[model samples]
Target: MKKFWKWTNLTESNPTERILTLNGTIAEESWFDDDITPQLFKSELNSCSGNITVWINSPGGDCVAAAQIYNMLMDYKGNVTVKIDGIAASAASVIAMAGNNVMMSPVSMLMIHNPATVAMGDHNEMQKAIEMLEEVKESIINAYEIKTGMSRAKLARLMEEETWMNAKKAVELGFADSIIEPDKKINEDEKEKNKASDSILFSRRAVSVALQNKLKSHYLANAGANTGTDITDLEKRLNLLKP
Candidate 1:
């Protein structure tokens, strides 16, 4: 299925102040979703009246749409600042660079990769797809270089490897400026440990049940309720779902 962009304003401090937000996939289709955003961006630029804040949280969708937005931001005379509240991946990362000053949450992530395309056809069709992808990659790489002042070769390598950088790494690599402190400290390591424990516990229960059935088959024994297998499975599943 073709992906379409989504946008919604989560917060607006003052009614009179102009704050334009574009959230979700930054694809070409997003322009059609609501011409209001693009028009507002243009209007603000033409007016050159107030500072504009653009908040972006997206996985990124289309390249063409991103380029259009980037150009508009570059043309604007007013102050432009971009905030990355959640994530800015793929083309969205490029859009984030449009901001005169970019801010990313400490836990936020930014990702970049060579442009991708899907195709189903013969060798010629496959070759065409590869060529298109290469061209798109070049365009994206150029944009990154312009924004981060990074070497084209290095950025291209990072894109080729589909690098995902967190806020700290982003700042270190010059993709982002500063890390905004969140209300609460996040411990991703603890979360990952809990996830691994749950997975292992579930697998143990599943294997235990199979073993129980084998024992019963050979000994003509009934595995009573609250057997090791049942208790283990119940406890494991419950623990896994708990908040």
Candidate 2:
């Protein structure tokens, strides 16, 4: 069976910071499958110590598996940092809520919606399925509420609407702490250079506007002297003032 998670130790000597990559579907096998059971994952997790950085890029699968993973992370002793580099939808979003510090890439997306299942039976069976789904939805809202501090009713409304959020929106909605940026360090010189560039751009636009206003005033003041000039000629003169 294909495993959804891969582990990498960042430092050989310290082994304090580990990276856990969860890609693709959360679980392709059944929840009880021996090869990909959450017990096996927990064993691997318990083998290590210190901080963990989880990188997730999944479309979501198997809500039960996701719930188990979320619980495992929450129970871990080490600090957990979750970085979503791609889409985290449906069940995957629940797992993300376990992070002590959740972050998303600028282009990453997060989606949440009501749980769904198929049922083939009479009206009684259909009602049973509906009740089950309602309970499952409430359980999901519990996770969202812990992370966002939003009211259960509001969260339920968002889930019912199938809310989608970009990195900025996720931070705004309290679903994520912040958006991830490049790790490279910028020196003071580079910072000043960027500031200078912005100032120069602003100054150029200001100069262009000032020149256009002056030309307009000049043309209007000399209107009597230049009766042959039409509005078209004045527009052409103003166009030349653009940088």
Best by lDDT: 2
Per model, how many backbone clashes are there?
Answer: 0, 0
**Candidate 2: RMSD to truth:** 13.8
Error of 1 at 161 (Å): 0.9
User: 79-183 in candidate 1: lDDT tens per residue?
Assistant: 778888888988899888887888887668888877876798999999999999988889888778887999999888788657777776777777877767567
Candidate 2 segments exceeding 4 Å error: 12-14, 32-36, 183-243
| Regions of model 1 farther than 4 Å from truth | 1-17, 28-48, 182-243
Task: Report the Cα lDDT for candidate 1.
Answer: 0.70
Candidate 2 on 1-243: residue-level lDDT in tens? 678999896768657899999999988877744544788899988888989999999998888889889999999999999999998999999999999999998679898888988898999999999999999999999999999999999889778767777777788778999878758887988756543123211133445568767877887888888767675676788678653
Could you tell me which residue pairs clash in candidate 1?
none
Estimate TM-scores for all models. Answer: 0.63, 0.73
Candidate 2 backbone collisions, by pair:
none
